[model samples]
Target: MHEMSITQGIIDICEQHAGGRRVLSLDVEIGELSSVVPDAVEFCFEACSRGTLLEGARLNILRIPGRGHCLDCGTDTPLTAAFGSCSRCGGYRVTIETGEEMRVREIEVDE
Candidate 1:
Protein backbone atom coordinates (compact mmCIF):
# COMPACT_ATOMS: atom_id res chain seq x y z
CA MET A 1 0.00 0.00 0.00
CA HIS A 2 1.08 3.59 -0.64
CA GLU A 3 0.13 4.46 2.91
CA MET A 4 3.49 3.12 4.07
CA SER A 5 5.33 5.44 1.77
CA ILE A 6 3.09 8.30 2.80
CA THR A 7 3.68 7.57 6.46
CA GLN A 8 7.40 7.48 5.81
CA GLY A 9 7.13 10.87 4.19
CA ILE A 10 5.32 12.14 7.27
CA ILE A 11 8.09 10.88 9.49
CA ASP A 12 10.62 12.60 7.28
CA ILE A 13 8.68 15.83 7.46
CA CYS A 14 8.45 15.62 11.23
CA GLU A 15 12.16 14.94 11.59
CA GLN A 16 13.15 17.72 9.24
CA HIS A 17 10.83 20.21 10.88
CA ALA A 18 11.28 19.12 14.46
CA GLY A 19 14.85 20.51 14.45
CA GLY A 20 16.14 18.29 17.29
CA ARG A 21 13.03 18.77 19.39
CA ARG A 22 10.85 15.90 20.54
CA VAL A 23 7.65 15.68 18.58
CA LEU A 24 4.63 15.21 20.79
CA SER A 25 1.82 15.09 18.27
CA LEU A 26 1.05 15.39 14.61
CA ASP A 27 -2.11 16.57 12.85
CA VAL A 28 -2.93 15.62 9.29
CA GLU A 29 -5.80 16.43 6.98
CA ILE A 30 -7.27 13.72 4.77
CA GLY A 31 -9.79 14.53 2.10
CA GLU A 32 -12.61 12.25 1.08
CA LEU A 33 -11.42 12.14 -2.51
CA SER A 34 -7.81 11.50 -1.60
CA SER A 35 -8.32 7.71 -1.40
CA VAL A 36 -5.93 7.51 1.58
CA VAL A 37 -7.17 5.33 4.40
CA PRO A 38 -6.67 6.88 7.82
CA ASP A 39 -6.58 3.58 9.63
CA ALA A 40 -4.01 2.21 7.20
CA VAL A 41 -1.89 5.29 7.62
CA GLU A 42 -2.13 5.03 11.40
CA PHE A 43 -1.07 1.41 11.27
CA CYS A 44 1.85 2.34 9.06
CA PHE A 45 2.84 5.19 11.34
CA GLU A 46 3.16 2.84 14.29
CA ALA A 47 5.41 0.57 12.27
CA CYS A 48 7.45 3.30 10.55
CA SER A 49 8.01 5.42 13.62
CA ARG A 50 9.52 2.65 15.66
CA GLY A 51 12.93 3.60 17.10
CA THR A 52 12.55 7.08 15.68
CA LEU A 53 11.96 10.45 17.30
CA LEU A 54 8.22 10.05 16.70
CA GLU A 55 8.07 6.66 18.31
CA GLY A 56 5.24 7.59 20.60
CA ALA A 57 3.89 10.69 18.96
CA ARG A 58 0.13 11.11 18.92
CA LEU A 59 -1.52 11.17 15.50
CA ASN A 60 -4.54 13.36 14.86
CA ILE A 61 -6.40 13.11 11.60
CA LEU A 62 -8.87 15.63 10.24
CA ARG A 63 -11.30 14.58 7.55
CA ILE A 64 -12.19 17.12 4.94
CA PRO A 65 -15.37 16.88 2.88
CA GLY A 66 -15.11 16.90 -0.88
CA ARG A 67 -16.45 19.90 -2.73
CA GLY A 68 -16.88 20.73 -6.37
CA HIS A 69 -17.99 23.60 -8.54
CA CYS A 70 -20.68 22.73 -11.04
CA LEU A 71 -20.05 24.28 -14.39
CA ASP A 72 -23.63 23.83 -15.55
CA CYS A 73 -25.33 25.23 -12.48
CA GLY A 74 -22.66 27.69 -11.41
CA THR A 75 -22.87 26.46 -7.85
CA ASP A 76 -20.46 24.90 -5.45
CA THR A 77 -21.68 21.54 -4.19
CA PRO A 78 -20.67 18.68 -2.00
CA LEU A 79 -19.26 15.59 -3.64
CA THR A 80 -19.09 12.04 -2.40
CA ALA A 81 -16.56 11.11 -5.08
CA ALA A 82 -14.24 12.80 -7.54
CA PHE A 83 -16.68 12.24 -10.38
CA GLY A 84 -19.90 12.73 -8.49
CA SER A 85 -22.66 14.56 -10.22
CA CYS A 86 -23.56 18.04 -9.09
CA SER A 87 -26.62 18.31 -6.88
CA ARG A 88 -27.99 21.48 -8.40
CA CYS A 89 -28.31 20.34 -11.95
CA GLY A 90 -27.31 16.70 -11.91
CA GLY A 91 -24.44 17.58 -14.16
CA TYR A 92 -21.26 15.61 -14.60
CA ARG A 93 -19.27 18.68 -15.60
CA VAL A 94 -18.19 19.47 -12.09
CA THR A 95 -14.73 20.70 -11.32
CA ILE A 96 -13.16 19.65 -8.06
CA GLU A 97 -12.51 22.65 -5.86
CA THR A 98 -11.43 20.97 -2.67
CA GLY A 99 -10.82 17.46 -1.38
CA GLU A 100 -7.99 15.22 -2.66
CA GLU A 101 -5.96 16.80 0.11
CA MET A 102 -3.31 14.82 1.96
CA ARG A 103 -0.90 16.91 3.99
CA VAL A 104 0.42 17.62 7.44
CA ARG A 105 -1.44 20.44 9.10
CA GLU A 106 0.16 20.80 12.53
CA ILE A 107 2.89 19.35 14.72
CA GLU A 108 3.43 19.73 18.45
CA VAL A 109 6.95 19.59 19.84
CA ASP A 110 8.35 19.45 23.33
CA GLU A 111 10.57 22.31 24.38
Candidate 2:
Protein backbone atom coordinates (compact mmCIF):
# COMPACT_ATOMS: atom_id res chain seq x y z
CA MET A 1 0.00 0.00 0.00
CA HIS A 2 0.99 3.66 -0.31
CA GLU A 3 1.05 4.01 3.47
CA MET A 4 4.26 2.01 3.69
CA SER A 5 6.09 4.55 1.61
CA ILE A 6 4.34 7.32 3.47
CA THR A 7 5.35 5.82 6.80
CA GLN A 8 8.93 5.58 5.60
CA GLY A 9 8.79 9.24 4.69
CA ILE A 10 7.41 10.09 8.11
CA ILE A 11 10.24 8.20 9.76
CA ASP A 12 12.74 10.03 7.64
CA ILE A 13 11.23 13.34 8.64
CA CYS A 14 11.20 12.30 12.27
CA GLU A 15 14.83 11.20 12.12
CA GLN A 16 15.86 14.46 10.53
CA HIS A 17 13.67 16.61 12.75
CA ALA A 18 14.14 14.60 15.93
CA GLY A 19 17.79 15.63 15.93
CA GLY A 20 19.11 12.70 17.94
CA ARG A 21 16.20 12.69 20.31
CA ARG A 22 14.14 9.58 21.02
CA VAL A 23 10.67 9.80 19.58
CA LEU A 24 7.94 9.20 22.13
CA SER A 25 4.87 9.65 19.94
CA LEU A 26 3.88 10.83 16.49
CA ASP A 27 0.53 12.25 15.48
CA VAL A 28 -0.41 12.27 11.82
CA GLU A 29 -3.47 13.66 10.11
CA ILE A 30 -4.70 11.42 7.27
CA GLY A 31 -7.59 12.38 5.07
CA GLU A 32 -10.13 9.98 3.60
CA LEU A 33 -8.69 10.51 0.13
CA SER A 34 -5.13 10.19 1.36
CA SER A 35 -5.19 6.54 0.17
CA VAL A 36 -3.38 5.46 3.32
CA VAL A 37 -4.23 2.28 5.13
CA PRO A 38 -3.73 2.75 8.86
CA ASP A 39 -3.31 -0.94 9.65
CA ALA A 40 -0.77 -1.46 6.93
CA VAL A 41 1.14 1.65 7.91
CA GLU A 42 1.22 0.60 11.54
CA PHE A 43 2.40 -2.86 10.57
CA CYS A 44 5.15 -1.43 8.41
CA PHE A 45 6.26 1.06 11.02
CA GLU A 46 7.39 -1.79 13.24
CA ALA A 47 9.81 -2.91 10.57
CA CYS A 48 10.77 0.47 9.10
CA SER A 49 11.58 1.99 12.49
CA ARG A 50 13.80 -0.84 13.64
CA GLY A 51 17.16 0.39 14.99
CA THR A 52 16.09 3.96 14.30
CA LEU A 53 15.37 6.68 16.86
CA LEU A 54 11.69 5.95 16.43
CA GLU A 55 12.03 2.24 17.18
CA GLY A 56 9.52 2.39 19.98
CA ALA A 57 7.69 5.49 18.96
CA ARG A 58 3.90 5.48 19.09
CA LEU A 59 2.05 6.50 15.95
CA ASN A 60 -1.29 8.22 16.28
CA ILE A 61 -3.49 8.69 13.23
CA LEU A 62 -6.32 11.19 13.05
CA ARG A 63 -8.80 10.62 10.23
CA ILE A 64 -10.17 13.63 8.42
CA PRO A 65 -13.52 13.79 6.64
CA GLY A 66 -13.92 14.30 2.90
CA ARG A 67 -15.84 17.42 1.98
CA GLY A 68 -17.08 18.72 -1.36
CA HIS A 69 -18.62 21.94 -2.61
CA CYS A 70 -21.70 22.12 -4.76
CA LEU A 71 -21.15 24.27 -7.81
CA ASP A 72 -24.78 24.57 -8.81
CA CYS A 73 -25.94 25.65 -5.36
CA GLY A 74 -22.87 27.76 -4.61
CA THR A 75 -22.61 26.15 -1.19
CA ASP A 76 -19.63 24.52 0.46
CA THR A 77 -21.32 21.26 1.25
CA PRO A 78 -19.79 18.09 2.50
CA LEU A 79 -20.22 14.88 0.52
CA THR A 80 -19.09 11.30 0.87
CA ALA A 81 -15.91 9.99 -0.71
CA ALA A 82 -14.85 11.50 -4.07
CA PHE A 83 -18.31 11.85 -5.51
CA GLY A 84 -19.05 15.48 -6.32
CA SER A 85 -22.80 15.67 -5.84
CA CYS A 86 -24.75 18.73 -4.76
CA SER A 87 -27.10 18.47 -1.82
CA ARG A 88 -29.25 21.51 -2.48
CA CYS A 89 -29.43 21.15 -6.22
CA GLY A 90 -29.24 18.11 -8.49
CA GLY A 91 -25.75 18.71 -9.77
CA TYR A 92 -22.70 16.50 -10.20
CA ARG A 93 -20.04 19.20 -10.49
CA VAL A 94 -19.27 19.69 -6.85
CA THR A 95 -15.70 20.58 -5.95
CA ILE A 96 -13.72 18.97 -3.22
CA GLU A 97 -13.17 20.99 -0.06
CA THR A 98 -10.99 18.75 2.12
CA GLY A 99 -9.87 15.21 2.95
CA GLU A 100 -6.98 15.20 0.54
CA GLU A 101 -4.05 15.76 2.84
CA MET A 102 -1.47 13.85 4.84
CA ARG A 103 0.60 15.78 7.34
CA VAL A 104 2.45 15.40 10.57
CA ARG A 105 0.53 17.50 13.00
CA GLU A 106 2.54 16.91 16.16
CA ILE A 107 5.49 15.00 17.55
CA GLU A 108 6.67 14.19 21.06
CA VAL A 109 10.29 13.50 21.87
CA ASP A 110 12.18 12.57 24.93
CA GLU A 111 14.66 14.98 26.42
1-111 in candidate 1: lDDT tens per residue? Answer: 999999999999998999988899999999999989999999999999998889899999999999999999899999999999999899999999889999999999989
Q: TM-score of model 2 relative to the true fold?
A: 0.89
Model 1 TM-score relative to the real fold: 0.97
Cα lDDT over the full model 1: 0.94
Worst 10 residues of 1 by lDDT: 14-23
Quantify all predictions' global Cα lDDT against the true fold.
0.94, 0.85
Residue-wise lDDT of candidate 2 within 1-111, one digit each (tens)?
777889899999888889999999999888886678778888999999999999999999888888887877788776666775777786888888788778888889999
Best by TM-score: 1
Q: How many backbone clashes does candidate 2 have?
A: 0
